[model samples]
Target chain A: MEQVYKRTKGIRDDMVSGFCPGCMHGTVFKLIGEVLEELDILEKTVTVQGVGCCGLAMEYVTYDCTTSPHGRACAVATGVKRTNPDRLVYTYQGDGDLASIGLAETMSAANRGENFTVIFVNNGIYGMTGGQMAPTTLIGMKATTAPAGRDPKVHGYPMHMCEILNQLTAPCYLERTSCNTPANVRKTKKAIKKAFQNQLDGKGFSMVEIVTSCPTNWGLDPMASLDFLEEKMLKEFPLGVIRDKSREEEAV
Target chain B: MARKFMKGCEAIAEAAVRSGCRFFAGYPITPQNEIPEYFARRLPEVGGVFVQGESEVASINMVYGAAQTGTRAMTSSSSCGISLKSEGISFCASARIPMVYCNVQRGGPGIGAIQPAQQDYFQATRASGNGGFRMLVFAPATVQEAVDMTYEAFDYAQRDRNPVLILADGVLGTIMEPVELPPMRPEEEVKALKEALSDWTLTGHRAEEKALILPGGWAGQEDRCRRNANMYETWGKDVQVEEYETEDAEVILTAYGICGRIARSAVRLLRKEGMKAGLIRPKTVSPYPYESFDRLNYGKVKAILSVEMSIPAQMVQDVELAVKDRCRIRTCLRSGGEIMSREDVLKAARELV
Candidate 1:
């Protein structure tokens, strides 16, 4: 059997093993690397990593990488894309980075039709800064910020970014997926690849929101975390293509 | 390449495109919105990028990020918008990022009025942002100058690896005049710039080399501070100014931006009347043509009249400081979006004489 381990380009060698076991950032990072390599875009791509657990994503991606202030990755990526239209640009943001502090930036960038891909990870909590409840954290679910299972009466319901982005006519593609199982991971990878390809085709904004699991934050073992993602998280954040402007058969 | 009648703001936008700017991010503000509109239509045609940002703050940061990738990028806004961009401007200055900013002057401390005013002179020339960092400020009086200086701003920014400001007034932005556009630099030249500045730009690592990490934090940060100061010193050496009819004149009129044009008209009237008044316009506000005052023959010049369109006058202080006891000084100003008329400047100069 062939060995499966490999390091992504542009990642800092020392910080490669920092992700918590079964955190899913590492898996998503690997998936992104594979997509970039397969699409022949690794050399021409620049990734703007947002602050959060994903901010440390610079450690796992070998392409050109820069980190933005918390929740400012969309704005930064807009700059990078506008500056060098020939270069493929993308931003990896977490739930907290996208739905909370960066909501304005994310929505405005979408409205402006900036031609860049955004990979948003909806892990239901702010994993890096401790298990704080994120904007996408499901109502009735417990986390540091919401100790008593998130009460909708006090804290709003989970934000569905895919549905929100789908409402914007500027976005050429928008999808939601999960990475709890092998088949779901394959679907998530396809969604990410399509997002990149849309940019290469000069299509406007594209995004993939991956419903990932934070086992350490959820207080669940790796397998239980996967089960929680599929059983609980998927119900709140349904998995499907919310918008696909690129598909010829799809109706406006 | 061709001559066209264009507003100063429109001409500035055209010049930016001709100078090989591939990215433009700005929010719509009165007087300068023509610039972003021009880019909205032109940039996409060139396969470039144009974004109308959420705010001036976001727009400037977008320029900052784009410039870090070694591309020609710019943003334009009015006085209030510029105030919001101060933080990003300082960051760009500290990072030595090459970007162009266009400030079409307007009145007031807060959304004073959309009409042309020179009240931002102090903000543009001094402490526009936090830190002791200085920007190369170009004060364009004519629509033609507005367009030409915009191209020059980009060149100066790339050459100095710092932010450059094209400081024109609302009159310059809104008023129209004929301008002969210059030929654009080739794309290859801009790409070559990437190679030339690769040492500093935050591009990817070269083969077999450790990735260049820009030093962060307080450790040895003083050295970076010193480097920024050194850059300002070097730029000061190349200050630009325009002088007219100083020979055998008893009074000198010091002005910039639209006021400079008014001063010129006033000087013509004063010269026709044989009152012996001349004009000195500081084209670059930051380096401020300090030497021009040195060149003035104090023996012939009796006093100096500083003219501008602002209250609690700003540029006058610089003029007084520059001349400092060499000659008596008085200021003629119009606050509340009022322009200093030619007659007003003439009356002030006559009184000083």
Candidate 2:
């Protein structure tokens, strides 16, 4: 029988993935590669990979790519996108890289409506650093730094990046999605595709925040992590389109 | 090609533009605010881009991004702000992307003052950032020299695939001087220069070849470090120094940046008094003019008076390293915002004699 599916050319054939089993980063990265391939802009794309597990993309992506200093990917992408306006630039960042250390870089870029895309992977814990509490860590989630489970009194509330950025008028599109199920994974891909399309269309900032799981970091089996994600993670970061500038433009 | 009166910061910015610098990302800081302000007004006129980044950290990283595109990019900040940029600068150097930046220095161990001081000599030459990476740090004393160094900095950066620093002080950044501005490079020439770097730069296309860059944290860096060491060695030969009447002088004054400019006057004053004195000034402080120190008539020169704005004498350490106890070394003092007086330098020289 003819093969019904195959790996997208967006990923490097020699790509060596070091992602842990049950980690959703593999799924999210595949979606980005596939979306860039589907959009037929693979050759014109440059990936700005942040530190953490997300930095693993630096190893696998076939596109011209560079890793920025931890938390500076957004700012770096701003420079690349501005100077090479004809090129498609996007930054792939995790919770610690984005919402923690790089929050100002992200917010300032979003506020300026930089014509680029951001792939924000919010797994609620810092996985590569052995599961320290991330900005998106749930109120009661246990991390290496919050061994007794996160306490809001001391750790503050888990940050909702999409909701926080939604206050800015600059971002053209902001959406949150997950890859727990096949259907949710497909939705995540769609969200990612739309974000890229907005950038290609010269629309302002577009972001697809992927609510994901860190099974190893959470000290749970991959499948159990999904259960926990759905039960608790989604409550703090409900997945849906946060804003669509196209809809507002159509109304205008 | 004709001389024009210009302020140091604005002159450097304009010279950078003429030198084919098509991208600038900087935040406002004292003494260097005119750089970003000038770029904001000038870059768009030349079809270039300028971003007033949210912070110096963001600003330097923005330059990092622009450098990936092989565009001549730059950023500027003062003392503490430079400390913030050191992280991004180190990344740029590690990634081996060519870019230029300027430090219109203010006095500081920590935000010491808004006035000019040569207090960052060590930071500029030794520890610009983490990672033991060194730059061809140009300490231009006069506004005209600042303009010339800023103009040529981008090419040196591209040639070495390294970040270059124009280490200026507030005295230079704020002063106005007449300068023969470098001719503006044609726009097409700038494009061609940027395109020539496509083989290694991040052009964002894979039809030919994909370029992957790992900043600072890449494995197999021993080879890169070796390559950088070779480059630093080459810079030793290229070190530029001006030795005024060191042929038969007993007291030679040593300094860089504004102090160097002042020492030149002191040399003339000492000559008027029939005291054999000379000046040795290093134009580039990183691959410092150690050879110039060797050329000093150790047989005749009894002392090297190190003049600087920093009290504890930062540049004197380099002087000591260069002189290596061959001659008596005395420090002429100032700190924070205080500029050196020629009389202080002469007093220290006479005492040394």
User: Which of the CAPRI classes, incorrect, acceptable, medium or high, describes model 1?
Assistant: acceptable
Candidate 1 lDDT score relative to the true structure: 0.84
Model no. 1, DockQ? 0.31
Q: What is the C-alpha RMSD of each candidate to the true structure, in Å?
A: 4.3, 1.1
Q: What share of the reference contacts is kept in model 1?
A: 0.40
- Expressed as tens digits, the lDDT of each residue in B130-181 for candidate 1 is 8778889999889888888888888889988889999988999999899999
Error of 2 at B193 (Å): 0.6
Instruction: List DockQ, one per candidate, in order.
Output: 0.31, 0.81
Residue-wise C-alpha lDDT for candidate 1, range A1-252, written one tens digit per residue: 998867655354555457888888888888888888788777677887777887655545666766665677788788888766777888899999989988988998988888999999999998988899899888788898788989988997888888888788788888998888889899998999999999998988999999999999999999899889888999999999988888953444
The TM-score of candidate 2 is 0.98
Instruction: Write out the backbone clash pairs for model 1.
Output: A9-A62, A10-A62
